[model samples]
Target: MTRPEAPHALAITFFYYRDLPRAMQFYEDIIGLPLAIDQGWCKIYQICPGAHVGLVDETRGMNKWSAQKPVQLCIRVVDVNAWYAYAREHALDGLSELFENDQLGIRAFVFHDPEGYQIEIQSATRAGA
Candidate 1:
């Protein structure tokens, strides 16, 4: 007898935001995602190992996310300090408070996008992480 296979997801969402260049910098420089696909104006970057972070030109979509909300992607990272420092250096707007979890002993901070959406940067615990 053979075991059934589990279905694979279609990767992460391809986020569309305003100003492709600004969005590109946020994802590539701040969030540290590598550029995987770039067709000028439109780009798709690797968020995690297999997850892709896409930024489309929402201005052309009429009611696109970038046109409506523009910023709503949150990434969980391993080093919140480093992440916050980078955000500070770049003058990104976001919260400076760090939240600690007693159960998991993990801590995280939040950063806001140009549209005011929050991106959480979390640090992993040794074993309980």
Candidate 2:
């Protein structure tokens, strides 16, 4: 028998930050995600069609950013090189050179957010190239 589908229409990943304003600016100005919701204590940004990232104030969040970050947000896009160029032009810290992974069949790069969360932007490698 087939299992029933979940009722959720979108998936949201939360990143707790000590400085909410800084986090919001990064997601808005740097990453260029559109603000979808603002719940006073938290702000949600739409990363893509049905995916979102929520930035929450540490005082109001379930957890806080620590020395050891336990989460990495991965955004799948059509052009990894374009993203890399944009990040570099913005002087984003921890930006990595684009590389390919044969096993994963993807080309991607990574950069750190204001609160030290790793954000990976990737694109599927072409079949014949």
Candidate 3:
């Protein structure tokens, strides 16, 4: 099947955090995503070749988190087990054991960032699965 070209060079998902530095540190030091752009109020991290995540300070961002969070950032990786081990060592919040989902065709684990943002790390069950 032929695929159409994407219109944008990169895609970024932004999350608003009450404490920007804490979020930045979690993504940079723990998750190990490289800093792609550092705007004064918002920091962007490169997730992969064409995908990025932006961390925005609640005071500077348009929205704020209250009783509920509306986003879950899922990252597809080559080694879900490695990430799960790292999370275990770091004592990350809301860590979950690696499990398979035949419906989703992935083996994944879930954890929370510093600000309670759900992050899922997963690998395909099989090649292109």
Candidate 4:
């Protein structure tokens, strides 16, 4: 028989660089996620209030992408302007300025990690747009 599920969600996952150190820096410094685990060959970074993305050493056959790399992580935030400001303050490479979309209804910017994974930071709404 199957075991009962935990009361809480275990985690939300995202693919990251095969390199552990670079992955840690990208998520922890650039992305601003806290480092939950900093093992020598593996690291896990928390992306949201309760979500984590792990970087492993490819022992589990993970690391490389099969086809096209995954794009877009639509993380929700309390404020759009503040989020935009924070990304600007960091000034990491490939940091796109806030842009609005009528259909999606968000103001968002994009950043790239060491492994060239695209991470989009978005706000639910932008001022005057």
For 1-129, candidate 4 gives per-residue lDDT tens digits of 998876776475656455667777666776677887666556767776577777766545345543355675656677767877877887766788788887777777787666666677776664543
lDDT of 1 by residue, 33-71 (tens): 788877776787877766776677877543476334444
Q: Compute the lDDT of residue 20 as modeled in candidate 4.
A: 60
Model 1 pairs in collision? none
Given candidate 4, what's the lDDT at residue 97?
A: 74
What ordering of candidates by TM-score runs from best to worst?
Answer: 3, 2, 1, 4
Clashing pairs in 3: none
Task: Encode model 2's per-residue lDDT on 45-68: one tens digit a residue.
Answer: 999888999999989889866877
**Residue pairs with backbone atoms closer than 3 Å in model 2 (clashes):** none
Q: Candidate 1: global Cα-lDDT?
A: 0.69
TM-score of 4: 0.70
TM-score of 1: 0.71
Q: Candidate 4 — number of clashing residue pairs?
A: 0
Error of 3 at 6 (Å): 6.7
Cα lDDT of model 3 by residue, 13-120, tens digit = 989888899899999999999999999889999999999999999888887755477679999999888888888999889998889999879999998888888999
User: How many angstroms is residue 1 displaced in model 4 relative to the true structure, after the best TM-score fit?
Assistant: 8.9
